[model samples]
Target: MTNVRKGVWRMKRELYKLLLMVLLAILPALSFAQGDPITQARIFVEQKQYEKAIDIYKKLYDQNPTNADVYTEYLNVLIQSKDLKGAEKLVGEQQKMRQHHPLSYVDMGRVYLAAGKDKKAEEQFDEAIKFINGDDLMTQQIANAFSTLGRDDYTLKTYERARDILKNPYFYSGPMSRLYAKSGQIEKAINTLLEAGPGQQGMLEDTKATLLEFLGTDKKNLQQAQKTLVKKINEQPENPYYAELLTWLYTQRDDWDGALLQIEALDERNKENGDRLLEFARYAAKEDKYEYAIKGYDAIIAKGAKLPYYSLAKSEKLGVLFAQLQANYAYKPSDVATVQKEYEAFFAEFPQYYTSESIRDYARLEARYANNPQKAVDLLTKALEQPALRKDIAGRVKLDLGDYYILTGKVWEASLLYSQVDKDFREDLLGEEARFRNAKLAYYRGDFQWAEGQLSVLKASTSELIANDALYLSVLILENITPDSNFVPIRRFAYADLLTFQNKDKEAETLLDSLLTAFPEHPLKDDILMQKAELAEKHREYARALTFLKEIHDKHAEDVLGDDAVFKIADINERYLKQNDEAKKYYELLIVNYPGSTYVQVARNRLAALQTGTPAIP
Candidate 1:
């Protein structure tokens, strides 16, 4: 019997030990659950420690009975803890103190709603809405309190009551429209936002932004918005706001023609100096709506050469013509001749443009498209002699002259010109571009070490484009150098890249394919594909280019050229293929997948413009 008693004591000790260990483990969790007083109270409630949470709330309420934040928090804790009587007393005291305030009524209604007393809750909410005066602050507070309680219907009622008291139709339009949209009342949302008068022009942008958020590329919603805008325009014929909104709606639907027509009507009605027309044309040109852009520019030109915008119109029209020609991959020699005639006429009329970007673009046309590098060289050389040319323009022209020299086989002369610009603008973006060109010339000649050295220094350039290029070239060099110093593959690739730059497309393509055929498993495969894509793009073989880009994006997505491939694909779709939706998808993919890419910001901007149907204004 003694041994049995001893065994029983041992068993009891082991059971107590297990129970103590369990408590010790949970004690840390309990302590960790106790954060700030309110957080601790909420955590305790979530853990079903309602009594403890109520005690914390009761203390908090006693410490700051009149504070709204504290009062709301304490009331929420009580309601969540199902302490209905405590919640009633808490809100009742606030009502007695703030007899004119409507939030107290809202709080009481929330408590009643939690208790399933729907009729009582309705009555309390009604009483709160009646307490709304003409005070904007009080009205907003009441509306927000109701919104926070998930009582959107009462929230709408509160805003409507305030609007009636203020006698303003657009008083709560912003919030009310959002509420209506959230509740799937599309027509009401559109109408409520459009109801604002001319006096509310300051809120126009905000109203548009709200519409963008809710309407969001939905075909039916966009159509409804268009109808509402049309109705508003008709009702308020003199209001430019409605007309502008309607034009923007047209753009959102990709209806550039309609947008241009609307802008033309507005300009004519207002008897403006083609300022609005010019702005609209510039936007359209940026969006690749070349036909409408030309029409808009022609409208200004037709206003006569004596007008303020006549010369500007002529100059910009020449640029648009060049851009149109460049965009047309199937453009004929006649197209080039036609645009060249426009440039000659503009330069003949305004010799001052010899110092502008127009001159550089003209030179590019002669050298690149017309295959007359000598003419380009002579043109830029004469432009450089002009005394009125800005220092920067002179530098840019020198760089272009260098490129033309390269095209004309004046390799040493090209080097000299690049070096001159590099020396003159040693601290500018122009200088950086000059340096990159020199390095590229070196790479073309298979001087990899020197080119890599120059590129390494430029890897941190202030210009993002130059820095990205430098980094890419630097990485390519380091990646392709073999252990035994074999340079056959990379040398051929660099030469092919140079050939592509020189517009020898067939030779470049042949060399790239030979490199791929010779070295099937080379690290340069992706780079070769990228070069091939560039060659295809230059030739306007967009579908073929897309196939190559897709290969890189799929096979080398984690490689250095992955984002480049994606961005190039998007660019081709947006610029050459006219596939805006597809472009948006790839841009979005770049943003989501390669957030660190140098192209992310550009991708984001492009994506935003595509999604919002508006270009980002500089």
Candidate 2:
């Protein structure tokens, strides 16, 4: 009886072991059932096992004929499998139960299209459109379905048929434009939107942005739009928007003269309040279109002081003229005198501007170019006394006044002003400028170690201009100062620089010559040569400046000043001597030999301008 019980227990254990083996054998198949059958079918589709997916979907469809998702998905799979007959039979079976379903006809059309039976496809598509009669929802579904199938022809016809059946003037220009662009009919796309009229004009910018997205920076589409704008202007002469857009196109093409012409015509035709002219003037200045900018500003000034933008235009015009002077560097004393009279008259008429940035330009012109340092000092001092001067503007004025003092040999007075500004604006650009100026003042006074210490801290200044000036001065002092700590030649060079700033060209020249004689083999040779070149350039001695620059370029070609000499030579030839060919040659040489030089990019740009007849971006 015990043996019989043991046999029974062993049999029970064997039965349990067999059951566990069966579960493990079918575990993966059972995992498929963990999700819905449709999910399993999708997984099979993802794996590209369409036959297996179809079998699973077929079982699901048979279980629930009312499942529209299953029905539609099964038919789509049939088409994807290239089984047009199977897709047709599925649709027919669905129609028997769902005769009023709109997607039946759409599916039939799609199936026919897949089979390349155009005649049958057209019939089914026509039936689908009939259901969309006067209904935007039906139209959208049909059109979007056709689009999903890449059948834009049927999609377009659906929209057209809907509009006719609804008897509505509504047109789908926005969507149609997208369709046209996709089909490579970009011109048609632009025209369709334009013809959509003012109700849809707000989409114009978006439409153009999309068109430009295709061919970036290719102004061909813009020119095409220009042609349309011209036609619109001719057809509707009273419309100013088209004129403005045309002007904008011209400006986009870097054709400032063209934009200027259009802007002037609009201003004359509309009798505007100088607002448009003033806006265009500022735009031209921003684009470096100085000629157009000057013309625009003059137009506003012609409106006289009675207009709203007159004072603003006059102020901006003063800066623009000074900018033109700086950009060309060809300003004569007579030019400065003319602008100087305008500046005096403006300040005399409006003393309130003394507290503004515009006042600084007058002082700069007077002191730096007009050779009237005392007049500049008096004007700035009067401007500083204003009770409502902004702290920043006051700081800037002090800094400028300090510079004038340095130029006029009042080193102690300049040091006081610089210290005042430095103390007041401790962490601002004004402070940085003041600190740099003070360091330079120290350098000028032969305090090399102290100046070097101050400049080392300023090399990391947040203001790029102050940082660069500090760095250059630091480098100049370090590179030229003798190992024995003798600074006599540097001190004389600084004094010569001061003299040059003071318009004492002859004295500065004499000092530079004496320094060269005293320090024949000194490391300050390149610096002395640069000083002489600057003095000669300032004195309108282009030939003399070329000689000095040539000496540095040929003898000191490996020095820190070599690139500077080459760049300065190119600049003089381009601007002062107007030797375009020579300027091109020098710029090319610098670009070739000094590929890593700071001036290489500017030289390349200038070379481009010389070769292309376009304005340099400077």
Candidate 3:
């Protein structure tokens, strides 16, 4: 009995030890199930709490050294955090766990691609594809991986394989066409699109339009570009852009008649407002059809819609009519006179509506053609009095009045007018013009010394025009005059003349003042007045010159310079001012009143030139 109890006690001790071992195992498993570090890490990783996830993963890795899934999760979390070194170390561990596994290679490739190591990604993808199963999904994944590497050839091959297996070739047609186009094989691209058949014709049309736009500006490439658009236009003849392109092409070739024909065709098809009328007007004007141009202007005016360019067009047409009348002056004097009267009537009707410059032009015509210098001067003077005249116009009128004074042989009067103008607008172009004329007036009176002195100052004038004139006249005076000359008044007049020639008008004017002040009763007073008129002529102040000449005949009729001034008025009106009729009248007057005048021969030659429309020798 004692032996049996000992044996039972030993059995009970061994059973107690086995139960304790089971309890230990169960307690560890229950603890892991309740609080799994790896599960917590995965939850953190999913929530994008990477740092906490990484710490949990590292703790799990230390505890479960042989768990491949834990190693993978840790690596992925490191990769998610962009911890490349940690991810790489985890990848090495994964390789040991699953040698040559497709998932392992793909994961590595994904990591490499994310890191922008494209070559490494490509190598990994290539190795993964070699071991890939031939399932369509697997094949697609491999093909997509090749596309990410930008390996065009491999991508195409993979796509072709997909197409062969899938048997829906159209599925890849669009992408393949784009690829072909990108490779500069446009014809192949077109073929690919056509293979997709009529269902894709809309897409084909879009492609065609894009290609045409790209090639349109290249004339050399245009010939080879397929005329799909022309074909499309023939198929739909009423397309507006097609018609417009054809018209543009005609314009490019300068084929105005052809362009007009196309426009007529367009009009026949539909009566839209097609700018054809304006084009026709421009064409007729180019062909010198003043009457037709008037018709065009009238058409636009009749519309009464206040178009943007209506005023400008009407102005151009009126100008054209005036030009036509002026060109026929020699052959059709009556017609010219009638046209001049019509223009006058037009001005009378719309005097305040036209631009001041246009009104001034009309006045000039009246002066030249209607033998109405007083009327012209009156109009210009009235315009000048109105503060509405532009600065330029005001200056021009002043210059014109000075011209008239010189023309009438009132040289002193003309000089005073020019001086007043110079002072009023000293920095303006008109001021420069006035100064230049004053200097020339001095030169005309045999006052070389005065003219030269004025010219010398004018050489430094602000205007290039004044400076050029000063340089020219200064050189002329220096060459003409002797050094140390003693004829004081004559020298002063000569210098003033030089100033006028050089466009140093203000200085020439001052010299003229000094001369008049120094010798108010000198015998050359009439000569000085005549010189002013001559200066006006040199400066294109014809009307001023005429006024001066007329004054010489009126105020100092018996003086030799007075006779000379009257003859000069006739000569300048005909030759320089382009007032042929006025010139003819002046020449006739000189012949009638001064038969022995020195300008008769030249006047006769000028009369012949005007009658025959040829320039006569001076």
Candidate 4:
């Protein structure tokens, strides 16, 4: 009997030990599974399981009566469940326990508000603010509690009372600004935000961004901001922020000159190295405000010719002038000569630019505008020999030189250069450019088969310009030629275009007119007129150009190229003819007629500037 009892006892002891080990292993998991009572209550409340949430909150509050979060949640659940009496009793008990607690008063106020007892709620809210005294944590807690209950007035009062108690002037400005904005006192909001000062720059910026979100498109609001910023500038002239803000506001209005004025003053006042002016110049150029762009760059150059940004400014200024001429397609040879002189002076100071895009632009001005293909070829060839030139840059120079070679009738030389660049820069934009040029050379030599083949590959180029040009050329070849045989008219027209490029204009003109007479219904009618218009513009006979453009616009108004004629006519009036009223009318016509044209926005902008009397760049 004793031995059996001993075995049984030992088994019992082992069973107890196993049970204890299992419990030890699962204790952490059990705790994790239970999670936080408050979180569980919140989940139930969010799911609209208010009864379950109330049970959990009651248990939590009973377990920890001093836990403000638990008490607040319990009261909120009671109010949400429409048990107003229960919420009131709970808040009353909390207030009795912590009679002087500001948050207890806030809870009471929330309960009163939930019961539709407005006067009681207001009294409790006042008591809460009174109890807050000067404590930051308590004040913020009460203010947040009031805000949650939609008592924005009380929320503002809470912060204001705290600021007064603490004897701090700017303490409540951040929250007060939002309240002011909500109340439609926008100027008060602006003043409150400015009073916040430096330490709260992030908050200030966030509030400003919020203001801009709603007020950005409202001109009156923008003007209000402008006026306030100007007032601030006058009050504190040394504050760069005000001036910067005013400049930004001007840019938002597309007032590039106004922005330039502010930026110039700031740059001078701060004694900066023209970096700000350089940035403004680029912005003005992007907006097509060439006059303001030139002024901005000139301001930078006026700082000194040896500044870090001077060379860049000089180069970009030339580019802007070139763009102005291109936009209008009207230029005086004297104007071109003047720009070349500027390029010459700039190059004298920075010959290292010989291998850059600036030098290529200068060469293009000579080759295309000044009628000096040899100069373009010589400049690019010398640039190519520069050992320090970037390899990609050297490839670009080769491509450009090939173009000049084509213009000078060195077709074989141009073909060799193009092939070299294509081989060296395979799979790059420069290679695409070279290939496109070679394809054009093929077309110029009356080899449409070879031209179409290369163009088919280039239509998918990543370079937009190359792809667009390739597509345009491809369409011309396909539409003008029969499927089974080469088209003689297209071949002859291509030859004539090459002749025009080579400055053998009389021969080119004869060929074009002969083709027009030979085939009166040919698809190249508008195309031939466009060529003639370009030739007329080249000779500065803008009236003749306008005549040709009008012919296209009047007879072929529905053709694909009609919009080009309209825009060119508008530009000529705007620039060469100085008939701003007529220019405005033409631009408006283009806008109304071709709503989807890519030139519509450009026309609209020009029309606006014309109507507003924004001065054009000389």
Candidate 5:
């Protein structure tokens, strides 16, 4: 009997163990049921268990009456459940609890509007606005609430009331103008924004941004803005801001001549010693408005040589002329000579400018357009000898000299110069650029191992441009070298690249084409296409460049150069072809297709400008 009892006790222990395992298996399910109450309530609400959700919310609200999230979600659930009386009671309680806070009134108004109580909703909205004491936060809350309700009219009223109570006419003008523009009251929008004139604190750029949105390549709207700005300028002739806006409007309309006239008038009226004109000229130059830029700079130069702006105007005008000629593929030898003579005359007049940026510009003109790389080398060499030259300036001179050396087929000299700058500016972007150039020189000379070694280090460079270039070159070397040690294809490709760098573009194209025919399956095909595109761009053959770039984009989009091709295509379309629509399309494509690309931010900025009808300054 005792033995039988022992067996029974062992069986009982086994049963207990089995029961404990079953409970452990179900523990997770029980834990899930006891998870976050709000989440559980939301799940129940989604399943149409409104009663359960309301119970949870009621408990939450009871625990913390001032918890806005709990109250908002609870009220939302009640309204969705068609418990109108409950929702109304909840909102009313909240209103009383907060001394009828304006936002609570807005909440009540939203409820009334939901219940088809239009009259009561309007009353509630009016009450909310009446409570506005001109406090910025309160006014913003009331206006934003009305806006959220799609009651832009009430939003305007709220702002208007706040403006009146505050006795500040320009109060909320930025937002108010947007409202006016949204309702097609563009003239009212314009007037409201400009009424405060130059005294409108921080509103000018906001107003411009608003106008950019509405005026968006609309001829009629642009004309309307122009007329309004003209009237404002006339009414407040002393308000330079009005004149500035008028000038900006003219630019938006592409009436650059009109813009220049306005700037000149402002400069003369303000007795600014051509400061404003100089600024306008610089802007025009940056926009590639060469004709008007030259005109504006000439205006400044006519102010007399002894005036503060005269020397600057002369120097800047030379830059414009050089830029104009550079951009003109069909420019004459006489045009080159004319610009060269201007540089010489300027240097003759101001010998001290040998150390200035103009000297580098002069060297670039001599080497690239004038076909005098030797002369350019000589010129920059002399500039380097200047006493007390800025280290950065000296570094830049060396880099430019290196390029001229490449042009002159002095490869070793160019490498040496780059190495000097690389050592001198060891921790600067200038140094990174110099290192990258030396690496590129190595790649050009078929020293792939050395070039790859240098590029690996530069892939972590602080300069985005340098790092991107380094990464590309490093990948190119790594990908092209076959396991069997065959370097023929990549070697020829690098040689072609070197030819292109040396301005032997025809030779480069020939070599690249031959390589394609010889090694039909080479991976350097996209690279070759990119090089050809760059060559076309250099010669201003934008259509040809687009053809090459489009091929790379369509055929090798998943490759490393995809974003580079897209950005270049967009740039060519916008800056050279003036195809704004095509430019916008490519920019948008880059942003959507290459979100992780280095060019994403620039693409977004350009796309925004294009969409807003203010194409970026190329």
Candidate 6:
């Protein structure tokens, strides 16, 4: 009976083992049927195949109808892909599956934050905190959410709450302090960090230093900033940043001695270049330290650096010192001369160092401050010798020379210079200036005829400035001369005067063409033509003007002014300009041309006057 019981029990155990094997074998197939899709979906998730993972997760949810993890993972995938609508759908799925998962709210907040829906994110974070019963990580995350939304007020409140619940002040104190500082509650931020424990003490000191440095720029806050910086230095004596800050603060307060002390300390600390010494010189100069500026420049020169900028720096310093001396002792001639000599010496030493423009400036200083026209002239001439004087400088120097001559009352010399400047160049705006000056010199010399003639040509000049000036002067001369009929003879005479003034003998001779054209039998034609001849003679164009006068004696024998023309030509050729041989023939022509005319007596008088060196009246 026992054996039969043992066999039956063994068979029962065997039967149970067979059933377990059958169940084990079927389990994988069932799981394949049920879980293969989820596994493939999870693979898709891991591989970042979001759309496929979302589709498979949705199918798995439909099949199981209660798997919250499937919906959560699907939502994560949606969030990863930045699909807000799909994430929102997963949110609904979570509500259906679990009713209240804190992760669902947190994840929804994340989606809202990613989508820039700040208010939605805030609400989701609030909901997450409630679902999690104020979990520390969740509360901190809520604070981060507020920070991301730039809601500093909410962020501060959330962090304050988190700090209280977490019982650790350091949790958000650093960020809160920064937020306070950013919001301009700097004092409060400093106090808050100072109240924090030793781990943050150094950070508080650094923050205080930065805030004080910032405030140092304001006039109202400078004293307070000074105190704060001094405290920072005393606390961290080895910190170079604090030392530099104190140096800058001193400069801001215009405390040069303090700044220098700090700079010297910095120089010792870092083995810095001597450029700081140059900067000290600049600061001293700004304080009207002329002697100190010179000393500074001399010190740099003594250093034997041989830098190009060093030369320029010394030059600038010397210029400043010289300018100060000039301004201060301008009334003292000896002082002025002394400074002027120094500047001259400096220029002589560095002749090729400075640019032409700088040299021009120095020349102006010599002219204005030292009253040395010769020095000014020499400087400008030297500038002209430079190879790199630009066209503008060349033109300006020419104009300056013309001005110098005009100022010195050498009007004729100025005119000659101006005329030699090519009209093409003179026809530019500067050229107009040269031409205008030449014409003006003529006008100033009472040579209106010459002035107007030059003006007439200038009126057609290329420069609008020259043309306008010429048109104005021509109109003025024309208006003054052509007012009446009797002035016709005066006009003819004035034409000769104008031509003589301009040294245009040929044109003066041609002006007779107008007289001959206007009145063929005009009585004054002999006088008019004779005047042309006299102008030519006066200008040493005697051969040319004499030809016209001889024609008058030969052709206008009966004319009244012919004898006068002959005698005048003889007088001009003889005594005044020393052309004796030409004088005899014109004297004879005067006696032959109009024997009964009044000029015959004067012609004989001139003949006698020329022979015996007596004045002749006609």
lDDT of 3 by residue, 1-618 (tens): 699999999999999999999999899888887698777787788899999999988888878856868876787788879998777666766667777555566667777877889799768756665654446676666666566656555555655665666676565666666666566666665455434533443454454454444444455433323343345447667765555544544544445556566666674476543355456556656656556656655555554445554554555555666666654424355765765665666656555533366656655565555545566667777777775677767777777766655544567887988898899888776777787888888777776677777788789888866897688667655644656534677667766765564355667767876887888876556666776776666556778878878877787776656557766776676556667787778777666776676666766777677677765632
Which residue pairs in model 1 clash with each other? Answer: none
Q: Cα lDDT of all candidates, in order? A: 0.88, 0.82, 0.65, 0.84, 0.89, 0.65
The candidate maximizing lDDT is 5
> Any idea what lDDT model 5 has?
0.89
Q: Show model 1 residue runs off by greater than 4 Å.
A: 1-43, 55-74, 81-94, 168-170, 183-188, 218-224, 329-334, 445-453, 471-497, 507-533, 540-618
Count clashing pairs, candidate 3. 56
Which residues of candidate 4, in runs, are more than 4 Å off? 1-182, 195-197, 200-211, 214-227, 230-239, 250-262, 328-330, 478-486, 500-510, 522-618
* lDDT, candidate 6, 226-336, per-residue tens: 665677667867665556556656766767667766666665556555466567678777767566556656656665546434666657765775657644622566766
lDDT of 6: 0.65
Estimate, for each residue in 389-419, the C-alpha lDDT of model 1 and write its tens digit.
Answer: 9998899999999999988878789889999
lDDT of 4 by residue, 1-618 (tens): 699999999999999999999999999877876797777789899999999998998888888889877886788789889999989899888889998788777777777877889899888888888886787888888888888888888888888888888876668886787797787777877666665653355554564565575455678767777788899899999876667767877988777778988998899889888988988888888888888899998998887867888888888998998887666555677888888898888888889988788889889988988889999998898898888899888888888888899888899999999999999989888899999999999989988889999999999999978997898788878888777644878988999899998888889989988988987778888888888898887777999999999999999888777898999999888777888888888899899998987789889888888877883433
Q: Between candidates 4 and 6, name the one with more favorable lDDT.
A: 4
**lDDT value, residue 416 of candidate 2:** 98
Clashes of each: 0, 0, 56, 0, 0, 1
Q: Where does the lowest 10-residue lDDT sum fall in candidate 5?
A: 196-205
TM-score per prediction, in order, is 0.78, 0.67, 0.36, 0.64, 0.74, 0.36
TM-score (C-alpha) between model 5 and the true structure: 0.74
Q: Global CA lDDT of candidate 4, please?
A: 0.84
Q: For residues 1-618, could you state the per-residue lDDT of candidate 5 as single tens digits?
A: 699999999999999999999999999877877788998999999999999999999999999999999999999999899898999999999988998488888889889988999999899888888898889998898888899889999999998998999898777888888899899999998888788546766667877887898778899989998998888777878877778888888888889989998898888889998999998888888888999999999898888887898888998898899989977867888999999999999989987888888899999999888889999999999999999678899999999999999998999999999999999999889999999999999998899899998999999998877888899999999998757756998999999998887789999989888988988767888998999899988877888999999999999999999999999999888887789999999998998999999889988888899888878754
Q: Tell me which of candidates 3 and 4 scores higher on TM-score.
A: 4
**For model 1, what is the C-alpha lDDT against the true structure?**
0.88
Error of 4 at 257 (Å): 5.6
Q: Which ten residues in a row have the lowest lDDT in candidate 3?
A: 220-229
* Decreasing lDDT order of the candidates: 5, 1, 4, 2, 3, 6
